[model samples]
Target chain A: MDAKITARQVYKRYPSVDGGEITALEDFSLDVADGEFVCIVGPSGCGKSTFLRILAGLDTASAGSVTITPGADPRKPLNNVVFQEYAIFPWKTVLDNVAFGLEMRGVGKAEREATAREWIERVGLTKFAGYYPHQISGGMKQRVSIARALANDPEVLLMDEPLGALDAQTRKVLQQEFMRIWEETRKTVVYITHSIDEAVLLGDRVILMTAHPGRTKAVFAVDIPRPRSVESTALPAFSDLTYRIWQELEGEVVRAMGEEGQIKIEE
Target chain B: MTRNTLLIALTLIAWNLLFFIAGWWQPLWWLGLGVGFALFIWLADEAGKTAPLRYQRTYEVGLAVAFPVLLLLAWELIARNEILNPRWFPPPTRIAAALWDLTIHYDTFNKTSMFGRPWLFPQTLAAEGWPAAWSLFTESHVLTTLWRVFAGFIIGVIPGIFVGMIMGMNRTVRTMLDGVMSAIYVLPKIAIFPIMMLVFANPFGEGPKIAVVAISAFFLVAINTMAGVRDIDPVYIQAGRNYGANRLQLFRHVILPGALPVIFAGLRLALGTALIVIVAIEFVRARKGVGFVTFYYWEVLVTEKMYAGLFVVMALGVLLTFSLQWLERRIMPWR
Candidate 1:
């Protein structure tokens, strides 16, 4: 299979203040086919987010190679990220924030704004096009952030817990939106989340990663039928899939906690 | 009006009326003013607790307007009663009269006037070339200080922001400048006037005074702008880079706008410091500015003119600050 995104033996290490190297990711590897949505779930500090950053070119892997196959249009951006926080510029209006990538790439004003308006409309933020980030609610701001990434039309979308900061209600709405958008566009996505349910619902294959010196533990093909919404969480197959993934994740989460001294180790 | 609102208004009026009839007497005057102020605040706070959005703004403006009026009346009462020697104190009315006098007549001996009668500008310009017209404008006290302030402010702030942006983005540059900037920023700007005079060819001319003011504004703006730029949220910069922004695009779209509100705060501070420095410089060694006008009138013992001169300075500072705030709102409507 020709993969759209590739990461091989991706290793990341940081110099700890204690004068030793702390490995964030060790032997981390993944290959995602074109138009595939891959979700990786792990405890915090597992370096799942680190791997996404490497793939997005925001961070570097110390040892391995990662590349995204560029689209036919040379000018199309390689990748765009939706960060954990609503990283949209506070000073820009919703329309301007969405148009920012095109503007930076030297697109003409009328054309960029038109494209931004369409994306804003698609995200249901048409009424807030002229409003600043401060004027909008957190949910609306995240919508703007998502629209901003989507408007650029990158070859791959890297979401590092994009819905992590939202409330449960808003998260559900955005998760459904994400599934609908993915179904429509089928763009390559590397989604990092702490929620197994989210991974089972959104990804073509769910990749579970072990914590601290993070490495891939298992990959589960979703195989569940589409046209899925939050309603799919009620299905036995979805629940079974989520439970099985969580079973693998449970040991890692505990080990992560014991390492942090939040939960004591008896042995 | 609600009882609290009416009571707040009535308390303000009653204080004014009581002082108007009773006049200001030392212990009683200070005590009454203090007691009345506290009572008025209580009423205003009581009014605010239930006031609708529309009426809250009215109370705010009312409180603002009343406090200064009361201060003016206190000044009048204190001077009229000979409590503070009116010759030096000069009640507000006498100061107003002195201001009017300065406005109407040019003081040929001092070579100064409030505005040099701008109504004659067309006639003057027709009869005279640039030099003559320029000389005529420089004779006005208000215009003289204003020109020096504007010139020094523009000269200082432009380079200040440019250098500040440089220092902000470069760690080495910032570290190199930080210590010296901190030292100079606190030193009294008026103390530098003598050195600035030695540097200029014409010590007594406009050069040294404008230079001193410019220097004061420079350090203030440079340091403040550097802080403003350095303090910008880092995530925005990351977002800019991730969006395919080049260096110039990142600077334009992220760094500058992110630093703007703090930069404007720096501007407001620099403007205040600039005015204070120029006025002090004029007081020591000049003949055509508001500070010089105030000092000259004091030398001749026309105390009211001195107070008028001071009034003009206060008005200039307030007017400049308000103008800066308006410009800020225009530039950063996002705020």
Candidate 2:
């Protein structure tokens, strides 16, 4: 399989408030194949978000390298991120927010608006085309965020806990929509999440990282057959795969919690 | 009264007692005001609990307007009963009559009228031309003050937004000028009128008056604009960068729109400040503005006309505020 995203020896460090150097990521490396759905799950503060930010080119690795494969079209954006916060511009209407990426790419207003309208329709937000981000629900805002990234037609789609802010029922509904959309488009995806079931249900491979100085600790291939739906979560194979990943995740999670407790106690 | 209401009234009385014992800032007027407020609160509570005036709609607007009406009624009663001197503290009806008189009559001495005689404009324009309209507008006290405020506001707000954007985006610029801006901001704009007079060709002319208004407005606008820019969520900036927005594009797409609401807020405040500075400057210096007309009445001991001048200023305030609200609604339809 041709590697669409390649990172080697990615090391990130940040200066603490007390002026001590803290390592966020150490020797973290992974290769995601072309058109692969890769979900990264780790304990809280495991640098999953930090790594995604680096991949999206919003931040640089302190040392080592990360790269996304160039598209044939020079105008194609290298990657677009669907941030956890649903960072849709509040001043912009849904149509405008979805068209923002295309607008930034210097696409003409007519073409971009048309493209944005199509995406808005696909996201089932045609009625909300003129609605600002503040006027919409959390789920609706996330839909706009997703539409925005897809409208850009990026080489790599990066998401950092995109559905994490949604209520549980909304999350499940969006998860189904996510599955359907991913099946149709088949874009190279790198998603970060805290939900094991989500990682199992949606991802081609679940990549788990260790507690703090986070590095890739394990990779589980989701053997579930595709054209999968919400019904796929009910399969025996899905639960078995989820349980297996949870077994490895348990120790890392405990260690990460202990570190949090120590920091609070010290404070 | 309920225990809570009773406690509050006692607390207010005790607060006055504490101040009285300390022999501090408590005056007769202060004690009276506090007692009046406490009495009002207690009465309001009793009324709400006992009478319980329930309706399909609220009386908030009615209550608001009623206070002024009640105050005016009390003033009329006090003045009629000779509780205070009526000449200096003229009755509200006298003030209203004076306002009407001021509106209709033109002062040949000051060589200016209140509204430049809009009634004569059509005949003048037919006899003369468009310049007649402008000449008439210039000859009015209200128009003169309005022009100064308009000129100062336009001059101040544009540069304020630009400089503020620069200060907001560039840390080095902000750090270098932030202290300087703050220092100048706190210095009363009216206090620098003398320096402005010295700087201009005409010491007591419109130059210093307008310029002082501009300076006051500029600092207010610039400071608020910087805050607006700073207050934009960093996440949006990150999103802009990630989506291949170059420096110019990021500013145009994200920064400008994001900072606009705050910029409008600053503009609103700066406009109010400009009006104040211009009026005060006119009071001290100019011969033709509304401020001059108002102060002139006071100097001549025409108490009713002085009240009329105040009423005109308030009318201008209401007009300007409503116009600004209209403009804001036009510009920010999304809000």
Candidate 3:
């Protein structure tokens, strides 16, 4: 399979308040094949979000390069992000927010509005297309955020814990929605999350990262069959795979806790 | 009667008895009235404590109306009995009468009226064209003040937003202007009237007055716009850029709308400042604005007319505020 995204030896450093440099990512590398759904799971402060930002070109890697191979259609954006905060503009109606990316690309008003309306329908927000973001529920806002990213027709989608802010039930429902959408479009996606269930359920391949100057620790392929859904988690193989990945992640999480000595494990 | 009601009735009776027995107004009698009023209020409060929940709103409305009416009655009585000088502090009734006179009195000599005699608007329009009709409509001191405020507010707000947007986006510009803006913002805009007068060719014309109002509005708007722009979420800007928005598109789609709520807040503040500065300027120099009439009435010691002029100023403030709120609703429907 051809790689849609390529990254090599990526590094990120920030100037700490104590006047010393703090490394966030060290010697990180990733290559996502075209139409692949990859989830990067890590403990807190593992720099997964930073990596996503670098791939989205919102931030530069301190070293090495991240690039998205251009598709045959040059009009498409390289990547579009679905932010954790569901950063839909409060001033814009749902339809307008969905059409925002197209508008930014100089798409004609009628065409963009039509496309936005179509996406809004796809996200089951047709009735709420005229409503402002503040007037909608958090789950609905995330749907608008997702529809906006998709409407941009980007080569890659970068999501940073898009479902992290939602309640458990809403998160599960959206996970199903996301699965269905991905099944339909097969767009290359780089999803970051702290939830193990989410990573295992959504991604074709789950990549684990270690904490403190994060680097790829392991990659697990889900051999579970195609057309996955919330019911797919009921299969014995699903829990076996999830348990196996958790075993790998648990050691890194414990090592990270020991290194920081700040995390309090709650009941 | 209920205990609380009886207590309230006795308080009122005692209030009347004290004034009737005095047969003459005294400062001491006022003290008696105050004590009786306090006792009555206490009794009313006690009565309300036991009232049904459904009656609470009614009780509140009654108190709201009765308190202000009672105050006005006291003012009328005091003024009529000459306890306070009526010449300087005319009663509300006299002020109302004066306001009515100002509304109807059209001075043929000065060719001006308080409200331009709207009753005669059709005649003016038929005898002349739309210009004359508009002139007649705006010939009042009220309209003159309104026009100045509206003009100055627009002139000040437009550029204020522009400069504020630039200052908000660029750190270098913001830092360069921060101290200067703070210094000027704190200064009283009226203090610059003399300089404005010197700058304009005609000191008595509308130029200097409008300029003062504009300057006051400009600083407020510029400062507010900068704050608004700076307060926008960085994520939105990043999203806009990632979606292929050029600089102008980014500004139009993201920065402008994102900062609009704060900008409107600034516009409101600037509008109020514009009204204040224009009034002060009119008080200092103009021959035909509401503020000018107010000060003129004071010079001639016509306290009732002076109060009427103040009432006009208040009315103008309300009218302008309502108009701006209407505009704000139209511009920011999402809010």
- Best candidate, DockQ-wise? 1
lDDT score, candidate 2, position B159 = 91
Docking class of predicted structure 2:
medium
Clashes of each: 0, 0, 0
The CA lDDT at A152 in model 2 is 95
Q: Where is model 2 more than 4 Å wrong at Cα?
A: B1-67, B130-132
lDDT of 1 by residue, A27-142 (tens): 98889998888999999889998898788777888998998998899899999999889789988899999999999988999999999999899888999999999999999989
lDDT of 2 by residue, B1-335 (tens): 47766666677677656655775433344454446565655655553554435631244455567567757875775565455688998889999999888777877887688888888899999999899776888888889989999988888888999999999999999999999999999998999999999999989788888788888889988999999999999999999898888999999889998998999898889888888888788788888888988898899999988988888888898888889889988877678
lDDT of 3: 0.89
Task: For candidate 1, give the lDDT of residue A193.
Answer: 91
Alpha-carbon runs more than 4 Å astray in model 3 = A255-267, B1-74, B81-83, B108-111, B128-139
lDDT over C-alpha atoms for residue B57 of model 3: 94
Off by over 4 Å in 1: A262-267, B3-27, B47-51, B122-133
Looking at model 1, give its docking quality level: high
Error of 1 at B116 (Å): 2.3
* lDDT comparing candidate 1 with the true structure: 0.88
Model 3 Cα lDDT, one tens digit per residue, B176-237: 99999999999999999899889989887888888888999999999999999999999999
The B-chain TM-score of model 2 reads 0.82
